[model samples]
Target chain A: GDTSSAPASDAATSSVPPGHAGDHNSVKYYKGIVPAKDLKVWREEGTGNGKLAHYKPATKVDYYKIGTTPTPAQIAGWTIAVPPSGENLPAGSGTAAKGEAIYSTNCAMCHGGFGEGKNNYPQLVGGIGSLGTPSPEKTVGSYWPYATTVWDYINRAMPFYAPHTLKPDEVYSLTAYILNMNGITKSSWVADAKSVPLVKMPNRNSFNWKDPRPVTHNSACMKNCVSPSSIKITSNAATMNLTPRLTGPVDHMKNGK
Target chain B: GATMIAASARAASPAPTAPPADNSWSNSLGAPVDARPYGQPSKYESSVVRRYIPWLSPTRLADASFTPLQDQPGIITSNGLFFERYHSGVPTVDPKEFRLMVSGRVKKPLLLTLDQIMRYPSVSRIHFIECPANGATEWPAAQLNSLQLTHGMIGCAEWTGVLLKTILDEAGIHPDSRWVLPTGSDGAHMDRSLPMVKCLDDCILAWGQNGEALRPEQGYPLRLVVPGWQGNVNVKWLRQLQVGREPWITREETSEYSELLGDGKSLGFTWVMDAKSVITFPCPEKPLTQGPGFYEIRGLAWSGRGKVKYVDVSLDGGVNFQRAKLDNPILDKCMTRFTLPYWWDGKPALIQSRVTDDTGYVQPTIVQKHKFWGHDPVYENNSIQTWQILASGEVNNVQLS
Candidate 1:
């Protein structure tokens, strides 16, 4: 690094080596420089009574005190999320036998008649114990850890076209039917708030929640990283013929695909 | 005969200073302001538009349209050209009728209209939102030929909104609450359980994009902008926030977003995007048209953890690396532009760009990524991409062993 020794009293536009007078490398740029170690970050306690420390607000006045309190009816209408505990599930029950008719009409079009999946739509059942295989099929039976997810999803987004139209009983019935198709429950078993939570999914304890990241710490190996002869071209996308035609700048351009 | 000879003489040796005849636009008057209340790009720029493969999704309603990364320049993606990933069709949300309900494990549950949300002290920050499955199709092989198709599942923009912490503070979050389930009001009513720590951090309830009201396709009324996190958790058409003790284990978190492994186990809650960079210019669509001359290679690099510290350009397929100049205004968790001056020799070269974030994590190679995570886990494919430039200045997507 070149040291800047230009006189402070000189003209501001001094033509010096390594840096111009106005740029960062100039001597004047370091006139009021502060040491990096002295700078410290401090956060104020968040407005919420929670213990987490948050960034200090720019102003002292409370800006979020504008909204009005929601009424009991409003709260009940919007609070629809159901956790794995099933404590928030609505009062409803359905049998897998009764859910069979609902599945064929509503879900069978996309999720397949037996939850095997159709087209690009998600498969809901089967593929149990197939995660270790070469090609694992991650259906609801083999992947979902909780049965409440099935109920919540169906109640919230289902029928492929008409979502949030299913009654609580219909959602429960669909959940039961999907579970029965996966061989997790009997057709006669009743699926209520109580029995649904207790129904153990085959892959309930399958997930590793803690994110183990930075899995590959590849360094910048710049020199002769790999042998030229050993480097093989494993695949080429141009030969695949999967690229879609578009009206973009490359509409007329061809890469000899 | 004299006139014909003069015409032939002019055609054979035209004066270099003479202008061409096709200057119609220069001679004519441009359109007036009244012509378009809302401005649009030039007619010639119609080629620069978002596109999608029809077969990618089951239906058009629940699909994704990729951004034209090749055509885009700089960091900020235009509001109209930003990538769109909708679970169902875009719902027509009336701002006057929109109400965001904050309930579940809160002391005073509040119902806030769009106007009330805008009243809070607003802060705008630019950040990139990317789908977890950005390069999922190219894991085993480079399935998409164009850069837009391969790496267009991301868009960076300046989002304006109130801090979610401020709203949650007013609601008075319960001490036991660990998760906040954000539910969209779209046809799907898409819901996802976001960890409470993330909500309190940089998450904002964004209502504006690129200095304008949010587009209907981008959740006109309100949308949660979880910076650096996966796009799926940033629920658009945000209508409700339910603070809870446990994660709701929604469909997205389970069978959809979770990464399945070959050992009969899956990794859940993998939110943050790793360091990644890709060269936009000299890509498949924008190849080396100006053959064998001084060319400035341009690209975009970003990370979820922090700012990109530096980017390295490799002209010889990772054989050698040289630091590319990173453009200024490098903010945290935002796209950073990088450029490298090069003289192409018109030879076959494997061009690649590698990014190292502030955390000192170098972007992994495709082989390195597959070695640890295998060919599955169809998300978080931030591996270094290779564009094979042939002798004829044509580029192709290829995977190297």
Candidate 2:
């Protein structure tokens, strides 16, 4: 099944899988993934060792005719994800001044008028160098590594109440306005694909990742793992008492009523 | 104990005029099988349902509800009770109208219907899907003081669907196709580009959860099941899988999810969720009562990379630990329930559970995890949670240094 690793060669050996040859003329593996008509043809006319001795060859491979090739137009419509590179940037541009109006009309309610963020909503401006501090202010300008992410997010999921409602140019304007709020961009700057990716957000390189991690590790210690006397309570939560414990009358008490 | 003096007759039953009356159909025939048609959890379980942190998001329309892990009985999370995190709202899609499009750098780009998808030979495997953000608030010791609040962002279910490779094979994956972008049909169009290696490995295009059709919140009709990956990568209501060469580095993977360290350097392709575990019992919700005599400290342990190797329980912080008995049938990538029965004599106690997966990566202490990822970005904080149980039988979520 791991056909990717082994390149098919012209000098076929007994060990080579039925369809793993590198060339197009090789016994390519369908693995039962063909269309209904194609599968029918394969069952009848295919000359490969599919029709084996005594065994139903079709039973070995599992394939389904579940999906179809989407039209180019459909992919264009659905694949709206904008990466950090700002590739596939739409044809539109807007200035920070234009973005200010769009931001107030659409995003101001939840994100705050000036992108200060209200309540738990994310603040879009300020906190330029706060990421390294004990208390970080992660905003569009301060912590976002890529400026295109802001534009992509607004185009996709912003306006909290109405997602994907903003037009491309509106999203650009809003991106510009938010970047300007963070001082990542000038008020006169226009945000298009080329300019948005260059906003150079602060704390852009603050995220750390290592896969297959125990980037920090702990072995299974059966006893005396650490000095019990050395254990210290760094934080106390009893005084805060933020957890909501809603208590009500019990309706069921195992009585036969 | 004070002796009970006989109270007034009215105090007994408010001037009991009628003693027997009737049974009031208490013994009547139970309601017919179709009396209520579909089934639901009993009304008494009203409080056992999911709860969301109201401060996390503005409305339930685009927010996550923590699984009631503390209240849950076993490893199989109920379909209705499964934890759901939705960036956009849950979309109402007709299976007949749904078409999964597979295109880009493939020989046979295909758009398959849901019926056609079911035609493929299906495989059922139980895997735990965890949001890396599990126990995020406790990373900096915020006040979300419950197991449901701390560790409820994960749930395991027996997911049934066709292997992602089965479909990719049908599409004739080109050698150039290094990454596959599976996009959600929700309004947000949430999409995550999974590396081709992971797609070909063990991912599934799942439509069934816990032996039934997926609940709407759980991405009904279809969703991608990237076992051991972040919950966001499992795009629900999957609409398309475009095979390509480069990772899209979408918003879900970039602007969010990626961990921001104290040093201001972020990691982008941190795909596989690390090993983690938590003690569900004696949590803030299940405070130790009655002197905690012979309490079986039970909890769930799991890792994205593989099976949970062993879980250890520490009675006095992390100073010492004892091997906890893991319940039978610890499947790979599924939650393993671990229990350690210990006798207690009503003393102040600090309890913690540590996990190690089959990969031999031991679950780190809170201090150890923070050492790697300092502060601010609060995703994947799967550190050992220490619960301080006071002599008064009240439990508090505490961090030990």
DockQ of each: 0.25, 0.24
Predicted structure with the largest TM-score when compared to the true one: 1
Can you give the TM-score per candidate against the true fold?
A: 0.87, 0.82
Q: What ranges in model 1 sit over 4 Å off?
A: A1-64, A248-257, B1-22
Q: Which residue window of length 10 is worst by lDDT in model 2 chain A?
A: A1-10
lDDT, candidate 2, residue B368? Answer: 82
CA lDDT, candidate 2, residue A1: 17
lDDT winner among the candidates? 1
- The deviation in Å at residue A75 for candidate 1 is 1.2
Q: Could you tell me which residue pairs clash in candidate 1?
A: none
Please, what are the lDDT tens digits per residue for candidate 2 over residues B272-353? 7888888888887788777758888899999888999999999999888898999978998889999999787799999999
Per-residue lDDT tens digits of candidate 1, residues B1-401? 99999898779766434586446676789889899999999988988888876657777798888899998889999998998898889899989999999888777777889988998878999999999989888988988888988899999999999988878777776555556889999988888877677787889999999889988878887999999998888899989998765566688888888888767778877889999999998898888987898899999999999999989999988888889999988988899999999899988889899999999999999999987787877998999999999888889999999
